[model samples]
Target chain A: MNDQLIALFITFILVAIIVVIGFMSGRDKKVRSSVEEWSVGGRNFGGLLVWFLVGADLYTAYTFLGLTSSAYTSGSLIFFAIPYSILAYFISYFFLPKLWAVAKEYRFTTLADYARGRFDSKLLSALIAIVGVLMLIPYICLQLSGLQDTLQVAGKGYINVQVIVIVSFLLVGLYTFFSGIKGPTYTAIIKDILVWAIMLFMIVSLPMIHFNGWNPMISHITKEAPQLLTIPSSGPKAFPWFITSAIVSALALFMWAHAATGVFTAKSANAIRKNAMFLPLYNIILTLVIFLGFIAYMVLPKGTNPRFALLELIHMSYGGVAQGLAYATIALASLIPCSIMAVGASNLFANNIYRDLINPSVNGARLTMITRCMVFVVIGLALLFGIFFPTALVSLQLLGVAGMVQIFPAIVFSLFWKKQTREATIAGLVVGVIVTFSMYFAGKSFGINEGFWGLVSNIVILLLLNPFFSKRAGTNAIKQFLFQK
Target chain B: MRKVLLIILIALPIISQLIALPFVNSIHPIIVGLPFFHFWLVLWIFLTPLCTWGIYALQKAEGSID
Candidate 1:
């Protein structure tokens, strides 16, 4: 335990060092002096940086720990994760390029910008902003929780979870506040390097090292825990929850402020399209990670907290150095996305609410300053909530996905549906949100996930009501949309 | 050609899963050594770049710049 604690301490120090160095790279105080610099990295990311930045941001701690826990507990159902990312990239490829085109034409920065620009509706934009900020809080909490869990297990004897969370965020906030998007941008390069090495090495080495080969390992898992290889839950309990969660996750993934944040950073709409084309290879690395989760389940003891499978596997087999590398990778995984998510949520408040609503006369520098301050506030709230609520990481994650996904029709569909009136979009959004929340809370109380119920009602209300308002958008709107090409 | 390639790429995963689990179960050689699902995803990734590049070239020649 003391050894694990030391290892975790070393990992924390490494992240602090990397982040500070990255932040120091933003020495051109001229660039660091504006919202464009702070929020979107001066609106300049080439394919190389964009690839790593988007890759690191999208493939998150949830991918690292949450998916593994699922693969460990359930079986082939984990395959849903791999395919959906492919589908997500495909969907984003078509829609995002068009979005990028519109954004460039109008100088739109956030998804709220795009929403308002398309609908000519400030109320709809505000509503989108509200939903985005609301969903962002829990997402940040989950990242902090992932950091906390990793530290708690990796450094059990010496440091406390609260201290690790505090130290990690403090370092994270300092760099993000100083450098904004560029801080995470540079660090992502390091993150991906470690990610690629560790992912490739483990997928190739451990199966052969621990159990002879892939086939033999699968045979071992089947003999030991056959249920781990198939969807184990029956009825509405596990399977329905799992299936609904998958669909919901795939739908909501890009709606998160960070997804758009990444999208907005690309060089062109076409770059967004091209990156989306090849993005699922990242999923292959994720496959290795998820499979490692099952391998851990087959090997680890009964109550081994399933979340720490990858780190523990490295530790148990390879000892402290490799464990340190794995621990550092997961820790930074949480940290980089933590910075990005906080920054995204901060931008929504600064650009949409504070600038658009409260002041309307604030300068870009002041807006950037407010965003930094709001980021601190967002991170503070997340840490407090994570410590106080401490429910389950998986549940908080699902709720995050479910909540954000409720915006899918509004954001994704609106781009191609210019006839989507601001008023009608709001009507659908409001009704969709209400049904989603009511079902979510009612189901959650009854020991089921709230999202499944909420989404069902939300989708029904949206489809049932869309046609009634569809005709109001007019012929001009239809021509703009149906002929976007 | 582009649409057909993407369909084949996307279709590989669903098809490979059927082959890998509950069915053949030991049918190797999706690409010789890669497991069926992993192999199919790799194929998808490899084909995606080629497909997109071709589509990009075609679109450029057709003046679809925006």
Candidate 2:
């Protein structure tokens, strides 16, 4: 058999193993009994499991492929991921433990649940749930595209890539419905291990084998394309953009629904804190991935599509089995996170929107089933959206981060500040979302990040309007959220 | 004193990444063959965790965490 076929065969075998693992993960009948149990593994995971789950959940195929491709095209701009991740953990170190505490006390299953319980406003809860689901769809679509790119490289014109993507997503949707968070949590261990091993091996050995050594690879880039080595001081993605993007992304990291889902799964507040301290270890691998991008730039021929830089490089360099294994790693990277994201989005819809608003009388068992069924709906929407309007999804995916950060005030401020008012938060969210989208569409941000502008307006409105609404501040729920433990 | 220290530990990553960018945003003076820009970011990737660990230690000592 040819190289592509050999690689394809290996990828199929590995993917099959993971699918089986996903199916068998929810063997315990308890995992299927309630929304909480199914959505968060009954919130009993220790630090290690949370670490693996969050690690696998956050670093999707998009990060792997997108970072490398960004490095290939824009040079040092991609390095924003490194610092943002570091800053994210630092921020999470403070807030997530507290948030987890309140979540545990209130039986909060989603961020919307936290908002609803904190502010005593179902309107705010439904708004947050809608925003979470909307932001998450584009992100899920991103993973699909990542999967599509991996298949295209591996199949090499012999196989149908779209059919495989849809089938794989359907399989993921099925297991996610049956196994709930447990499937992704358990399967995440396998995904993280494979990703770390393969990525580390590739980063260390690829340059040495291809360019004789790391020093020589650096020298080649320095001599040929020196600008690839440093962040440009003035331009669209200049130093200002870099700094703002990092800070904005850091602030927005934990606000993503999937990220909160990962946090809510931890057994203890201390588990979240410990995970924060250790999670930066994943950044080490991230830095290496960025380096892989630089390496791809050096090795791949000019005019190659930047999106396929890393995958194409692997295809050219490795044999069939190695290529297949690499492709499978990327594919699983997409699949695992997509499953977690679907769960996160589905939980928001079922818990906050359907149960709280539409039918307050829904039973726990029925709620669990509703959440499970919403998994397919979420994945199906993302798949259809990806197929019909790929470019729109890409642009919206850019807005996803800026858009999700709008919730920062509503969720984070209500945690510590006793004077935080729901009226101000809702006003801020409205202004923030409007400003973020308008700035993005207007094509003018004064070279600063659009999210930064949105957040500024959002905070300004929040602070200015807060004192007027102080009468409703410092409710019993706020006190409970603050000192619950 | 503990609160001040914890605040500083948290701010270390932000300072290194955002505040110190312009000063370190250059390709010259490669360290161990990495551009100083790359080297600085990679250094903080490792060091940021230690900062978090410091905060963790302080919080643990204060009995804020078990």
User: Model 1 off-target regions past 4 Å?
Assistant: A1-10, A232-234, A237-245, A444-485, B1-62
lDDT of 2 by residue, A52-169 (tens): 9999999999989988988999888888888888898888887898899889988888999999888888989999999999999999999999999999888878889999999999
Candidates in order, TM-scores: namely 0.87, 0.98
In lDDT terms, how accurate is model 1? 0.71
List lDDT for all candidates, in order. 0.71, 0.89
List the pairs of residues colliding in candidate 1.
A5-A155, A440-A450
The CAPRI quality class of candidate 2 comes to: high
Minimum summed lDDT over a 10-residue window in model 1 chain A is located at A473-482
**Using DockQ as the measure, which candidate wins?**
2
DockQ comparisons of all candidates to the true complex: 0.25, 0.82
Choose the strongest candidate by lDDT: 2
- The local lDDT score (0 to 100) that residue A485 gets in candidate 2 is 61
Error of 2 at A116 (Å): 0.2
